[model samples]
Target: MSNSVEYQQSGSVAVITLNDLPVNSLGLDLRTRLLELFRSAVADSSVTSILITGTGRMFCAGADISEFDNGKALTSPLIPEVFNEIDACPKPVVAGVNGAALGGGLELALACDYRYAHPDAKLGLPEVNLGIIPGAGGTQRLPRVTNLKVAMDVILTGKPIKAGKAERLGIVDRIATGSDFLTGAIEYTRVQTVSKNSSDQIVDFKGNDRSHLEDMLKSLHPVREQSKLACAKALDIACTHNLEDGLKMEWALFKECHESPQSRALQHLFFAQRQATKVPGLEKTTLPRAIKSVAVIGAGLMGGGIAMNFANAGIPVKMLEVKKPALEKGLASIQSVYESAVRKEKMSHSQAEMCNSLISGTLDYQDLADVDLVIEAVFESMDVKRQVFSRLDEVCKPGCILASNTSTLDLNEIAAVTKRPQDVVGLHFFSPAHIMKLLEIVRGKETSNEALATALQVSRLIGKQPVVVGVCYGFVGNRMVAPYSREAFRMVLEGAAPEQVDQVLTEFGMAMGVISMGDMAGIDVGCAAAEANADEWKGDPSYQALQFKLKELGRLGQKTGHGVYIYQGREKINDPETITLSVELAEKHNIERREIGQDEIRKRCMYALINEGARVLEEGIANRSSDIDLIYTNGYGFPSWRGGPMQYADEIGLARVVAGLNHYRESLGEYGELWFKPAPLLERLAKEGKSFKDFQP
Candidate 1:
């Protein structure tokens, strides 16, 4: 046997221990060696039963997903064949689930005659998370071993269940109570009688099975609609066919889902997210500074949310404000948020109390003197930021890091106000910071590697995906979104209704259309952001003119129920007044009104984002194309199925993207020349017939 697997016989039990460290994923070499050992154990007359367990916390993570791209996944003695061999063995095979048994890992457990899992082990078929269903008899066997509801819940939701819950659901035969899991499994395997395999169990598919399947489908809330629908269809086939035929049918459906555009896009993001954690130019040996305590400035929604992230990470945090009333109000707001979470069962009361206890409010900068990190979440004005940073520079400790949560301002300028510019960095968190996953760590010209590394480390501690980006307006996400928002506003002025524009974007897989997003985010906020960069819009008087008009009329979005749309409760009703306002603004700006098609709206907005992303790369604002993809997918609500705008551009081919930009430049006339001018990098790549995937850092 290979080193990946350790084979030995304990009494009558042939102990086959998986020695692969880390996740112990089913790679080609590991799979081949495990099968060889299993067949040897079956052929030996001295071995009575087999006990299979892993070396570490993970019994198995799953099949090595990277192997699929390298063609090793299709090599001889595939994962299914190994499972089939175990199922056919004369000696009973017992699985000892030491930890997480996810995807193919859970499927392996099902092939055994009996399963004994550690109490802390987590088991589930989470293949749908990668845009594919369980192809290794999981769909057919899970329903046979457990009830249909449990199977549907496991496969559809793709969330793990603890061993206690798995035993309750009949997914696990028993939970091991001892400290040494392998010893307990060995003793249990020696005493157990031969049991029926999951594949040989009988299931009833009687009385309106289709209706039952539909009802099960309705209860599931998978991330991807394609995965949800496909898994449901696969389950229906599994119920209708025998074990041998059902495995074939399930494999076919799994292949269909694996080869889909949605699968490809999701897989790309899965890898890209891991890649984003690695800093390009930073040295591998650089160590991150310790962040023991944190302080957050400002006491508004953003400030309270930012503080909660540290508190949740088990780090004590202080919220600072200039006045007592603001400090009291902010602390009260934070308590209310924690209370709401407990009320909704999002977090247990004890967990909420513990996290809430770690947070306190203060009215002085001196209280932040001992803090390891200070993040200013004040207003967007540069003058206010400079004043705050200057004060923090004086009050903070010698090595304490000072960070600004400015979404669009220049980080280098913010760093300049501080005497310790090397310790200054940008930790831009999205609104409702405790919930949003994306955190853009902006690196200034003078920012030290230790500061950047600390930001990245702290981001992981707070469960946020950190993307290291260079100093620029809006960094990566907001900078590229500027053009996307511009196109949405311009289309409304040219004749598309706000609802029509929003509908096109949502249909194209944006979580929310740009128009609805602007309103949801507050129209006044948009106007303020545009005004912050007023010098850039000097030549175009019509730029964001409609939103400016809306702000003047006090129609500041959902808060007022009358920004660009009339909001009756949660319903978005079209407002004739908004249309009238657009017409007036269009004529005042001397812009022509014409009917716009759905395809045009999508192309103009998407291409604008893609073009700007290219410019961001050329300017070295973002580290890599994949980094931009991760920021957009995680932060901006760009559909993961379409990947990021850069990946989407690659999918359609860069030549087509450049061609579309040039076509618009000639058609939209002056507006096209101003906004649709292709980035030089994009144009050059198109000329060379290369894609963003080919562009190195």
Candidate 2:
């Protein structure tokens, strides 16, 4: 028997404990051992009942995804085969779910005659998140034990439910209240009557109204449509087919989805997110500095949102502004956000009040002296940032971490102004910082491991995905976006309408088009970022000319009700003036306007981003190719299903990407020749018939 599974006999009950450390994943070895143990218990006349439990916490997480790509996942005694054996066992089997029983784990429990779980245990079949449906008996057995609606919702949404909810839904027989979950399960099994398998039961969905489900299916965004289709198909099979046929149908569909490009991309992203947490050269033993109280330097929108993060995390936060009125306004903004949540019933009034109470406002920097962490969320200006950091250096106590929420500024330069460069880091939170999940943690040249570790810890405490990156102009995300946005603007100069550009990107699965994103982010904001990096855009005359023109005309964006398109409340309508301006700019630059195809528009914008990402990878600004993908997916609204720009490029084939770049370089003349030159890394990989995945940092 495999060491991962331990078998012991207690009276007439055979207790089998799964001992896989760190979440018991049901790999082939564990499945084989479990099957052997079940067969042994059945063969033993003394053992009339079998109790299955896990050592430590986790009953099981799911199939060993790390072995999915290899053939190990399909090895002998597969999960379903073991589950079938358990169901066929003459002796009664009870599953004691002490922790998370997700995906195949839930299927294991379903195969048992009865299941009991710890009060805090979670159970669900979340295979849809990996772009695949459950392959085991989850699709059929879940509907058998629970109603069709409940089963469909659980499997389709891929969300875990608590033990209490699971018991209420009849998915679990009971919630084990005692500290000894195994003992509770064993005791309950002793009194329970032997029953037919769950598969013998059938769910009646013929009279059920499925309009709400259909509406939910239709409401899914385009990027998630493929996964939704897989889910819908699985649910249909579960409702119509018998247990054996339904499991077979689900397995076929699961394989189809597992082999799809979307599945590969989503799976890549899943692993990439985990990889992003690891920083190279940082010792595992390096501990983070303790962060108790936090201080925000500015009381503006960004400042207030930053403060709300700490407040939500149960950490005390102090908001500082230059004046009392500004401080009061900032505090109001924070309160209004929490109040809206309460009004929407997302939180209770007491919870909102408690969160607000954790945040206090001040007008003086001296009050921040004792705070463990100080984050400067002022304007995106170097001089302003330097001044704030200088004051923080004097006022903040020793070992205090100083962070700047500068999205694109040079962290090394900002750290240069302070005596403790090791203490300075960049925590670039996305807009509406309280809601967005991505937090780019910029590590400066002189940054200490302890500081970086602390920033990563704080990011998690505030519910953010922290991607540690090297310091550079625009960092990893914005630097690549610079070329992408440049191509979008240049496409307009070549006679592509703003709506045309946006439509192509949105159709390709981006959350929004470049034009709409520009309007939402504010054209003036782009102009300011450009002006801050004026040296980088010095030679390009046509760079962001339309945005600069719009800024000059005071057509900032949605804030001013005019940008690339006119805004009527939340609706954006095309404006002839913007089109005329683009034509005028083309004529001023002595460029001929020509009709651009949607394919060309998409290729230009996406390739520009991909090529720049290669440059970022070559420069070591990003640690790995997948790190770039994580930033684009989480921070830049890039489609998670397509993976990030780097992964997308790998899917498109590096040789093909290079061919497209070279075609644009020769065809579009000077501007194309300048911008479409593939990065050396991309060129080398293309020449060698390789991919971004082949490049190791």
Candidate 3:
């Protein structure tokens, strides 16, 4: 037997401890050993009761997710087989959940006659997050212990419940408080009555009203259609079938989901998100500089939002503005966000007040001298950013990390004004910085390792995903977005309506369409960013021409109540003027307008984004392909289920993507050829019949 599972005897109770460190993930070896120990305990004449517990912080995280794609996980004595062995044992089996009992771990506990969990233990079936249903009898067993409503909620949403809540729901029989879980479980199990067959004691809720099940399904209806279908099928099997039949049906469904493209994409993203945190060459032992306090230079919306992140993390922040009114306004905006949270009951009044208390407003640059870090959230103009950095260099103390919150400006140029260029980095927080999860950490050419480390550490403290990218015109996200937006604009000139383009993208699982997103981000903002990279865009005259025209006409998106579409209190209303404008532009350029299908629109827009992502990878702007995926999913509203652009390209087959790009280039002639040419890396990968998964950089 493997040493991962150890068996011992305590009086009449057989104690089986799972000794695997770091959350005791049940792999093939551990599962095989567990089966051996369980059968041994059942056969021993002296052992009347069995107590299963785990050493270390967790009982078991789940099945070893690393083994999902490999065939080894399907070997004999699988998790379900082990659960069945435990269930069929004649002795009363007790599960001592020391910490988390998630996914298959929860299923293991459910197989036992009684469950006792540590107070801090969390229990749930979160397989839905990876686009699969619980395969090892979770759907059938969870509903039996808890009601259908609670079970569906837990399974569909993939949220864990605390042991206390689980106990209240009767999912856990008792809380093993103030004592070691194994000792408590042994003491509790010693007095329990042994049944002729423990498997027969499974909770039966066959006659219960299931109207609440429909309500729960309705509540989860907004998730992806595929996920909703999985949940519905699981619920149907649980509600209608017997235990054996339900298990068989669920296993089939689980296998189908596991083989699905959605599951593969989601699983790819699951690993990608974790892989994004690891810097290739950076030493693991290198620690970040100490950052206790931060200051923001500007009193605008961006500045206030940036300041709120530090304050929310319990770090003191100073907000600086040129005048007192502007400073007060910025402080008021920060306070309002907290107050709104209080009104929604998301936070206590005391917590809101405490968060607000950590922020202080100042009119003088000298007030920032004691701060450990200073971030400039001023205008996007290089002149404005340089002035702010130059002033910060003069007033800030030595060793202070200087950062720019510029989403599109050149970070190196901004850092050039300061003598301490090594300290300058980019913290590109999306709009509503306090709430958005993506924080692009732009490493300038001169940025030091210490400064990069500090920014990454601070991002985690503030509950953000920091993707460290090298400096460029628009960095990773925006630079890729430029091509994507270019295609959306060109589609308008080719006879597709703005709403049609938006609808096609939304159907493809984008959170918002390109035209609508541009309107929300403000047409002027995109125009200014485009103007900054004019030399790069000089080959295409019609690039963002409609946006420039809209800006000239004073239709500045949602803020101005007009842009690509007219807005009526945040609702986009189709207007005839945009179609008229597209026709005029098509005539001016001597281009023919024709009916464009949704598929063509989707291919053009998505291929543009994917091609740019390839260039970003080849240019070393991003460290890896997954980093681009992370940036798009977290920052640019790319669908997470599709696994971002690169993974999506891989799923579509690189050769097919190359063929599609070539088709567009040949169809549209000169400008199209220039724009639609696939990146060299993408072309090579396609010719080699390899996916982005084969990319090392």
Off by over 4 Å in 2: 70-73, 209-223
lDDT of 1 by residue, 1-697 (tens): 3699889999999998887889989988888999999989989999989988898899988898887662334887888889877877778899989999999999899888888999999999988778888988888888888766677779888999999999998899989988877889999999976857655676545456557787766775444577767788778776777788888888888888877777777788888988887887788789999999999999899999999999999999999999999999999999999999999999999999999999998888999999999999999899999999999999999999999999999988988888899999999999888899999999999999999899999998999999999887788888887789999999999999988999999888899999899998899989988887788678788999999999999999998988999899999999998889899999998889999999999999999999999999989898789899999998989998878899899889999999999999999888888878899999999999998878875
Residue 483 shift from truth in candidate 3, angstroms? 0.6
Error of 1 at 382 (Å): 0.5
Write one digit per residue (lDDT tens) for candidate 2, span 136-228.
888878878877788888988899999999999999988888877777888877765585575678865645535555656577653456776
* TM-score against native, each model: 0.96, 0.98, 0.96
1 versus 2: better TM-score goes to: 2
Question: What local lDDT score does residue 102 receive in model 1, on the 0 to 100 scale?
Answer: 91
For all candidates in order, the CA lDDT equals 0.88, 0.88, 0.87
Query: Best lDDT goes to which candidate?
Result: 1
User: Any runs in candidate 1 off by more than 4 Å, and if so which?
Assistant: 70-73, 204-212, 215-224
* lDDT, model 1, position 512: 94
lDDT-sorted candidate list, best first: 1, 2, 3
lDDT of candidate 3 at residue 518, scale 0 to 100: 97
